[model samples]
Structure formats: structure tokens, C-alpha cells
Target chain A: MAFFILVIAALLVSVFFNSLGAVSLYRFPDVYTRLHGATKCTTFGTIFIAVAVVLYAVGRLLESGENRFWVLIIHTLVAMMVLLVTNATGAHAIARASHRSGLAPAKAVVDRLEESCSRGGASQ
Target chain B: MFIFFASFLMYLLLVWSGSGIPMIEVVIGLLMATVVTFAYKTWHPEKRLSKRGLDPRRWFGFVAYLFGPFALGLAKANIDVAKRVITGKIRPGIVKVTPALKSDVARTLLADSITLTPGTLTVDIDDAGAFYIHWLYVEDENPSEEQLYGNFAHWARRLAE
Candidate 1:
């Protein structure tokens, strides 16, 4: 019963953060800003979801008192690991694609990079 | 493969705790993981296990660079959004950014960094390595090319350099 409550709490927290992240993406001014909010909030929400799964596995293990607990725990851990790697890597790829395609800061006063790159001088 | 071996060991521990399983089962599992690991190693024989000679000073500087610029951008976007919402003025558009990052990894870092920030969403990319960003607020009739690429490249170089 306690475990079920924990799972529900975790789910609610994850959902709340994910929607907040989406709202941030919709409300913010540029690509970089939206990515920042979305990535962090989603990553946090993912962690909570993983936590909920772990809690459920523990509950099942306690109830069954059997070997299936290990399977559940290991699979959940593996999924979490995959999520951690893929999310950050995907975010990096998107960011690079956005930058090289020609997006700029809204109110940037100075742009040394543009000057240096255009002048055949390597960026320091 | 390591994961499989770990799983087998876990299985052994579990069976030993609950009900007795044949030792042959554990040995077979270990053999499978060993074979898989060796096969994987052969497929990537030259892969380095760890990056050596990492410069700590540069790495720490990069972390600070990302944190500082990202925070500033987020706060600025928050204010911009608040104003835009109150004024009922939003000119959403997609602008292309050509970040002249020399390396693919560096470019990728910049792209994700930009996407992670508020108010900006990465829409598409081209083979020549350009980013298309959707803006929630477009203040300029003709946004400069540097406007999209400069800020991201600035911190990207600082972080990745």
C-alpha cells in the first residue's frame, strides 16, 4: 500500500515537471532556451519514473519473496542507464544541428565568433 | 557482456538464497557472457577505455562557461516572455543559424545547449551543418546570421575548447 502511494506520487511529480517543461518550451523566446528547460525537466521526470519502477519492484519482491525481483530490478536499471545515455547524446546532437544551421542570440551585442571565423582566424 | 555476467552472478545469489539451482546453469551463463564480451571486444579492438591526459583547468572553465551563459539566457527569456504575453505580441518564426564549429562533436554540443535553453526550439538541420531554430518572439525584420550562431558558438567554444 505504501509502495503504491509512492508510485502514484512519483508519477504525479514526473507529469507535473514534464508539462512545466513543455510550457517553458512554448513560452520561451529561442531554441536554446527551450532546449534547456525541456532537457533538464524531462531528465528529472525520467529519474522520478525510474524511482517509481524501482519502488514497485521492491514491493513485488517483498510480496512474492521470489527470484523475479532481480529480473525486475536489473531491467529497470538497464532501462534507466539507456535513458541517461541517449537523452544527453540526443540533446547534444540537436544543439549542434541548431547552431551550425544559423541561429543567433536575440540581443547579443558582440559576436567575436562570427568575426574570427570569417576573417580566417581560428576561434581562440 | 559485463551486464550479462553481472546478471548471472545475481541469479546465482538469488537461487542460492531461495531454492537450489544446478551449478551448471551458473557456469553456462558465465560462459555466454564471456563469449559475448570477447566477441564485442574483437569488433572494437582499437577502442580506448578512457580518455587520458584530460586538462582539468579547461574542463572546469567549460563547466562555468555553460552554467553562466545558460542561466543568463534563461533569465532573459523569462522576462521577454512575460513582456510579450502582456503586450500580446508574438512574431514566431524559424531562423537558420550557421555555427561555424570546426568539429562535429563541438557543433552537437552547441546545438543541444541552445535547444536546452528557454524560448528556442531546434526545428531542423541541413547536411552542411546548419541549425533551424523556431523563435517564440521575433523582434527583427531581418535577423542577422550572427544572431543565431554567435552566442551558442561563443559558449560552445569556451566549454568544448
Candidate 2:
């Protein structure tokens, strides 16, 4: 019963964040805002999904006492670690490339990078 | 040598329990790992694993950081971003942050952590090791170091520098 509840909760959380991310992509005005919504919401949602998988694997291991379940848990964990690291790196790369391609923040008043760059390229 | 051993161990783990695999396959995997490691070393002869980064104490600090500040910051940033999405109120801006960490790896880790947190995205790193981050809500035109890093820099220094 507890396992079921945990699984349900994780599913709900992932669905909520994923839907929110989709909505944000539609709602936001500019590229950066949309990127923030798309990247963060999906990453958070995927983490919850991975957590659910881990919890399920652990529950199975406890019930079955099988070595393969242990392997499943460890592999799931390694996949989660890879996902977390790669997601962050990929988002950073995209944001950096977008900014370098001259996409300005829509509502920003003070452009610090521009200010510094104009001042003898202090922001290389 | 370290890279070779680590890669071999990783290849063994990838075989995973070795229940059904033949002994010949294991030997082939070992040979492949060795070849890959040799190729990597030949391609990057100047790249040596830094002793400080390999310290056990630094590994402990990194584990602590993943559980402590990084986790807390991730949760907080997620909530903050969620609220901003709901309210449709954001004051986005790019700001420069100069962390005290001198090591390139430490600075890269800090930048990656900041980028992973929902409300901030690392946009650029200058030659002086300063970060320009795109913050979802810029509270200050000129944020202090504490505001920028919030104990992350300290952890990065401990773990990598």
C-alpha cells in the first residue's frame, strides 16, 4: 500500500511539472524565458521519475531479496547521475550559445554584459 | 595508469554480475578498455588527474555538497521558479559573479551547479574566472558574492581546489 502511494505521488509530481513546463513554453514571451521553463521543469520532472524508479526497485529488492533488483537499483542511480550532470551541462551550453548568438533578454533594463563589453571588453 | 585501471573497472561493472557472459567476452572487454584508455592518454598526454581532486577528503566534501547545499538550493530554486511561472512575474537579467575559487575545475563545478538550479543559468565565464549568469529574478543590480554563490563556492573550493 505504501509503495503504491509513493508511486502515485511520484507520478503526479512528474506529470504536474511536465505539464507546467509545456505551458511555460507556450506562455513565456522570449527565448530565454521559454528555455528556463523548458529546461528546469523537464529536469525536475525527470528527477522525480527517476526517484520513482529507484523507490520501485528498492521495494522490489526488499520483497524478493534478489540480486538482480540490487543491480537494477544501482544502474538506475547511475543513469540518474548521468541525467543530472548532462542536463545541466546541456542547458548551460544552449544558454551560452543563445546569448552569444545575440539574443537579448526581453525585459531586462540593465545589460551588464553589454556594459562591461563596451567598457574595453571587460566581459570576454 | 589511473585512467586505465578506472576504465577497466568500469568495463567490468558494465558486464554486470557476469552470469551469462563467457570468459572470452570478459577478456575482450578488458582488452577494449585498455585500448580505449591508451587512446585517450595518447590524445591528451598533458592531462593528468590532479592529486588534490583525487583526495579522499575532497571526495567526502563533494558527497556532502551533493546532499546538503546543492540539494537545498535545487529545491528552493525549483519552488521559486514554479511560483514565478504561476505569477508571471520575473525580473530577468544577466549579472557578473566573481567567486573566490581559483582552480578551473572548481569554478566549472560552481558554474554547473548554478546552472542546474532553476532560477539561474550560467551564461559565460570570463578570462578572470568570473561567471555571468542569467537569473530569473534579479533582486539586485549588483549582487554580492554571498548572494551569487550562497555557500556553493565554499563547497567547490573544499571539493576541487
Task: Name the top DockQ candidate.
Answer: 2
Clashing pairs in 2: none
Cα RMSD of all models vs. native, in order, equals: 9.3, 1.9
**Highest TM-score: which candidate?**
2
The model with the greatest lDDT is 2
DockQ for all models, in order?
0.11, 0.60
Worst 10 residues of 2 chain B by lDDT: B12-21
Please give the TM-score of chain B in predicted model 2. Answer: 0.89
Residue A31 in candidate 2 has what lDDT?
75
Interface RMSD of each: 9.0, 1.8
lDDT of 2 by residue, A37-119 (tens): 88788888888898898888778877878878767777777788888888888877887788778888889856677677668
- lDDT tens digits by residue: candidate 1, B23-126: 78778767866776687688988764433215677678666764587546644544444454445455565565676666555666676555545445565555
After TM-score superposition, the amount by which residue A93's alpha carbon in candidate 1 deviates from its true location, in angstroms, is 1.2
Query: How many angstroms is residue A81 displaced in model 1 relative to the true structure, after the best TM-score fit?
Result: 1.5
